[model samples]
Target: MTTSSAPPVAPAPETASTKDPATRPRRRGRTGKPPSALLSRAGVTALLALATLYTLLPLTWLLLSSTKSREDLFGTNGFAPGDEMHLAENLRHLFTADDGIYLRWVLNTVAYAGVGSLLASVFSVAAGYAFDKLTFPGKERLFSLVLLGVMVPGTAMAIPLYLLAAEAGLVNTFWSVFVPGLVFPFGVYLARVFSAAYVPDEVLEAARMDGASEFRAFCRIALPMLAPGFVTIFLFQFTQIWNSFFLPLVMLSDQDLYPVNLGLYVWYSSALSQGHPEDYLLAVVGSLVSVAPLIAVFLMLQRFWKSGMTAGAIK
Candidate 1:
């Protein structure tokens, strides 16, 4: 009896496999509520399709209409091709009308948009660089004032600009339009944003430490880095100046000085008032031609523009 006591048995420790099924915690799998109708992939694709259609509709109409005769332009459906293609005839008429004033308008547009955009980009970049990297008194206040200018519509500023031009004896002259195009407040804002995003302080510091002057550093180092931004600013300013009608309308009386947009308007107005169907055709063709440069510029610089837009988006 003294030797026969059984040793106490130890219970086995519980493990996952040994646990009761009902007592084990449920794991989370990939399960959730469905996305909303509007946010669904199908919905997003549909919206993009609609937007593309909306944007291309007018351009499609313009292309078809340009191929039509004056009679077909009014008679046929906007999207339909004309019975007879008259595009060449229309272009010839457009170029020859009013002693080839359309060509003058095209050149004027080129000069105003091209040169003005370039100059504006340069000035804006310089000012923006100064605002971002260089410190001075009243910098924030000055920038705030510039931001205010961006809020003001260009149309609202036209009258004041006209008054200033008149005071300077520059109204109805090329300089009136050209000078105003140079001072793009929005471009300044864009340049500052681009400078902050693209141009690094350390790079400038390195250049400066090497005894490079501020202006030299800007030209040699900062400017090349800001190339994409420069092109972005140029394209924006170009489009604005190219399509600018109100400013030129207020500032210019001479037909020779008209940009393509304003010139087209004048032709359309005269066509309506004078009962000239040919002028209507000319306007249409001129409009088609007017779009070419914009398309070309965008196509050429789109790579730079894309890079500029995505700069600093991630970091």
Candidate 2:
């Protein structure tokens, strides 16, 4: 061992930079991207920040404006708070002005958006799961029809829907709005994507082999996996229904049946056409009220929605 240890060690060749640390290039981070790529990433971040500001600016104005009276709203800068906060006054005015019909509109909106979205999600999930996992005659043809429905703008179909609703005597009722939304073609398409991506055919087959009926297997097994998809479809339809102005405008004449959007529109029009500016404030406050539910729903469901959106990204 002593003899082996005595073997000569070769002298290590030294780089010039190694000897003088100050002369050496600083080590970069392990980010494999080049400087241009880094700059591009920074640029993209800045662009997104600007876009976010652009989008939120009007909403910020709306929020600030809602707190002011009609007088202060017009007098003050859009982004600035008014002389006095009258949020409570505005809300009270909103509820009481139309004999509490605004509250009815809110309730009607909840019903249409909530129930219609739920039904749409269910129908979408069922149809999508069937289209992906089942083999039946006219499958592609039916899916093509659904795709065609998606391509046809809902607004273009509004007249057709109104005509059909008239034929069925469902016009001017919640059912008129509710029924049309339940067959959401976009929801079906999205559901198909999710079903294909998330639900495994092998698992369904296994469940079938284990003495489960198709519906039973779907409910007990596949449905749980489709949770994210359901949430996504629900949120989409909910937003659509909540923001739907034209359809409800066409369908319902009754103030009692009006959703928040249509009712708010009526107020906004009255404010403009009739020169009662306070009604404008009522419309603004009602907007806040209408938006609150959607915000709440989004915040509540975002976890599932985001996970659903990203789940298939890698796999």
Candidate 3:
């Protein structure tokens, strides 16, 4: 091969047109097969519709039942309108019955829930802020105790609280209900989480460097930022105090000091035991009236509430 006279030719690089169809890489695009039908848009929409129906059912029944007279209440369908509307008449009877004790109960409920929730929110936020920003001895241990409190149900604590109230000569008094409502362990936890998520440490440091006292920084800086959390805590505590029955039942024997929930219970019991259908009607209407404030409060603060609820999940 006397030096293989001609140089060997190199192989040509593959091109798209020259590549074999079986060897070519497939481009990423839609396939002929469709995705699984599970969790599709239609399925999600149906699930939401079902949830909405479930939630609205009771409220719808309550609204319809509130308009019915005693006869219509038992005679007609629960979800349908009555033969005649007795809403105005029912409200009149509700407010006037028992010398308008219902109004007093309403006021008591407002006071207990409003004042207690406000104070509780303030205290919780302050404690939570301290827990988050300020370091102290036994901080984790103290917080562990708070977490422990969150694990304990309110109903379980009712007996112990009643005993403490009795010991302090506070039973059957407003303080019995109002004082206990102020200690919200879960609210404290919620506020702490909110503080950690919402309040920036650098901002506090800047305030401190500018000669602001700790308390001043908290009030003027941290508080405004924590407004949503404050509203969240207030609403939670308000709803709890509003719906509380067992605690009031254990603490209060005087009907005059009763909250709306306990007062309505008394009316229902009287109706059942004393054969007073009018009392039953009063209880029904009173229940509807009692729910209105909660609805109004939620509607008003929903923006803040929604923001507060989602704050921890973001960061």
Candidate 4:
């Protein structure tokens, strides 16, 4: 009478989709052959090759041109190395000529770009985070002003900015380049994007509720989250300041304060008109040297950009 065995557990029901054998992954086609993966791989390889060539074109030209002397620049194959290797000779001329003035120009460029971008990044992050999370009067209006400033080309404001600097006795000085660079509208905009994407509002609120001051919460919690954004802003501002020629051209008359770009312009102009045509090699080499640091920076810090985008996307 006690032979009641537990009823067999009902077989687990399969979903309609799972029950269809045709829906299963197949290892072979109807002809007992594997699918061709070459087309997709070939397409990707071709695309990568094209992209590599496109990006390397300018750098290739710079490299080849740097190797050529005045005569070889036009006389030899545009992409080929010259018969004589004068990189050392050209560099010697660059450093020794004019009592080592090129070194001064290099220092000035470093000062302007390195220091200015650092300060600009800080200002942009602070402003951007404030705009994103903090409530204040006319915040939107202020951000709108920044947007308007972005639309207004830097060249358009060059005269006005120079005049303002002149009035303040800042023109033709290091301040003329560094001070103006610190006010980066595009950096602010990028910072705002990063802040919005990465820094969560709730985290700030929770920190505040725990008796943290506004500044304390930002410094402790939000600031760390914004590292990626800050890095991006720094890189962008760095590049902008590094490549800036026209602003320093108009604002500063002192050769000692000239950034590399403006300094290179001087060399190019001198080579063409007043100086030896052989100096053309120096100009090309100088141009190449000016860009090398930026290239190094990009290569070194590119991971931050990728991480920032990933973190922002996940947030």
Candidate 5:
């Protein structure tokens, strides 16, 4: 009985790394430190600094140049601050000239870009959702036309849009510029991609089972899923419409309805061609004023914009 009791012994268990060193991950250094990064820290910092300088150079020039009067603009050094910093005077002249038409131009830009982009986002999302979830004849054909539209430059459509506006008696009115910015084909395409990727079919089916109409189901169940996509499309359309020039040039004749870009262009042109070189400073200041809203908008909505762009890539 004593001999039998001594017969049983347990063997030690082999852990993963001990069993297979080749398959196991490499360990950290003796000090438990990670390996060197791809880029040296100092080298990476220097690269970023150079990039920052490259981007800021022009803006820096503009800032310094705006501070100069017309005389200083030509007479003094271009990059350095002039002796008489006339930024306040330049701004005053900018708003006061042409009976304060610059304010009207700014307001017109808001209507054309801000309001138009909002409407475009809604239409895009709705059309995209319908194209994805609903089955109808000619749906693919219609969507193909949309894809075709994206390849055509907005400039190429200006004459045709102008012709259409003339037919509708909308020429030279706010509606001329406001309406065109609202019809972005690429936005609809992007919304479709986001819809198919984000909105779940099973949830929509359940909403249908709960006696919800198609519109109600979309409004209640799907729109919230598409909100991020809307923000992305809105921002894109807003910037496009905001920076637009030729479309408004061809569509509108009333300077009172000009967007800031077109208005500054007229000023810069008149200043250069008409010998009122003093207005050049006004043009520079207006440019800075125009850029401020875009910067503010990006800063405010960048959180949603970043998330929206990356959402469909994951699922």
Candidate 6:
């Protein structure tokens, strides 16, 4: 006998750990997140919800108040719906009261936002694409100046812009609002980011090799790819031009040229000081109506924003 068969030859060492992949404690990813992380996430979500409630509370009050009679607004709970809904009557009075001046304001808003955003987006896209793809003297310097302009708040430049418009005899005219809205530094910056990311150099080179002129290549090849970015720029500028208050206030003395925001402000001021505080309800209703188009536009165009960001990032 070979000395008890050398103790039955111990099995080869397994080496691997006994822990199973599924059963073992996770070292990374969601399973690895500590209870503290979960608690932190919960805290963040709750904070955001509370912030949303805070922001929306005034709008909620406005809606409820708009439905109530003057007496009910003062007497009843602020959030309670009144016994009667006068929103329709209020709207009718609003539209018909001033010889349909409100409609003109609405049209003016549309024109300013539409024309301004379109022109601004075109200018921004062209400038951005040129800056990114074309090599020119002082390109970096010009871009840096644009960035500096971004840092300067529009309010600070409002007086200067007004003065320039005044000198050019543009004040109190639609051009006062439209032309200023069309020159957006932020739009230019966004366009540059998008152009750099989307319009690949190789593609431009190929287009040039095909004997396509620079403008032709851009119009035919690059512009299609830039469509998403254009929409994003348009939406942003649209919202900005639509919501602008101070510029319009400074530029135009004629109430007929007012956009919805300025028009609403007029109502609010009148409602407060004119002692017909009951008219406040109309102001609230008008506010609600004013925001509806913006919400609709965002919902419709948000897909373009997503696609554009994705396209640029992927490229």
Supply the global lDDT for candidate 4.
0.83
By summed lDDT, the worst window of 10 consecutive residues in model 3 runs over 306-315
Give lDDT tens digits, candidate 5, residues 235-290: 99999999999998897778988999999999899988998886777788899788
> Among these predicted structures, which one has the highest TM-score?
1
lDDT values, one for every candidate: 0.88, 0.86, 0.89, 0.83, 0.87, 0.82
Question: If scored against the real structure, what TM-score would every candidate get?
Answer: 0.86, 0.85, 0.85, 0.81, 0.80, 0.84
Residue-by-residue lDDT tens digits, candidate 3, 185-295: 999999999899888888899899999999999999889889999999999999999999999999998999999999999989999999988888788888888999999
- What is residue 159's positional error in candidate 2, in angstroms? 0.3
RMSD of each: 6.1, 5.4, 6.0, 7.4, 6.9, 4.6
Q: Provide the lowest-lDDT 10-residue window in model 6.
A: 306-315
Candidate 1 stretches greater than 4 Å from native: 1-34, 83-85, 308-315
| Model 6 TM-score relative to the real fold | 0.84
Best by lDDT: 3
Looking at candidate 4, what is the lDDT of residue 94? Answer: 75
After superposing candidate 4, which stretches have Cα over 4 Å from the reference? 1-51, 83-85, 308-315
Q: Flag the better candidate by TM-score, 3 or 4.
A: 3
lDDT of 5: 0.87
Error of 3 at 19 (Å): 17
151-230 in candidate 2: lDDT tens per residue?
A: 99889988999999999999998899988888899989998998888887777888899999999988987788899999
| Model 5: per-residue Cα lDDT at residue 159 | 97
Better candidate by TM-score, 5 or 6: 6
Indicate whether candidate 4 or candidate 6 has the larger TM-score.
6
